[model samples]
Target: MNASKFGAEYALSDDMAEFPAGHTGAFEVPYPRSCCCSSGDADLLEAARTMREALQEVWLVMDALGAYQSDDDRLSILHSPKFSSAAYRVRTAMIKTQRVAI
Candidate 1:
């Protein structure tokens, strides 16, 4: 399935339709069954691209939270080394996924 279809299938709630801000809700990534059954390189590439889009959404949520909580000392975890590392890792994975070739 394509990214929009995949997203619609797994969208958390109506509230999440608002983009980065509303994405504060719980997020889940349901593995696509096509990846297990299909051997085509194109299928694999599509799956990779779908996953990359999901990662981008996740990055956007984190970015929104980081910006929203930029001043609150109690929410400083958003600025912590561990959080930064995790965000960096997600971005690296996004780049890798984008490079997948058919």
Candidate 2:
């Protein structure tokens, strides 16, 4: 499943459809337009990308936990390569989003 599916409700909300062409629908947060040098679409895209990465980490962590067969297995899954990779993706995306020409 796509990571963004986790936030489908918010991402596909009616509020999104209400945004004007250039208005950064950064949702109700009122994140200043000056926060990014890029256009509204760019800001929204970057935010969506970051959200996807973060959700990926969440899913991976949950899956890892569910796959654990025993107490020892829990630690192994938590430190598993897949979980680590997903977490790294989230970390990088978060950093990228923060530095998105703000």
What C-alpha RMSD separates each model from the true structure?
21.9, 18.5
lDDT of 2 by residue, 1-102 (tens): 233756543345576678776764655665677655456568768777787977877786777677437878888877888778877888877777776554
For candidate 2, the 10 contiguous residues with the lowest summed lDDT are 1-10
Q: Residue 1's C-alpha lDDT in candidate 1?
A: 20
lDDT of each: 0.62, 0.70
lDDT of 2 at 62: 76
Write model 1 residue lDDT over 1-102, tens digit each, in one string.
233854645544676666686455657798877654456576566656666765765665567565445457436756676567667767766666667654
The list of candidate 1 runs beyond 4 A from truth reads 1-36, 41-70
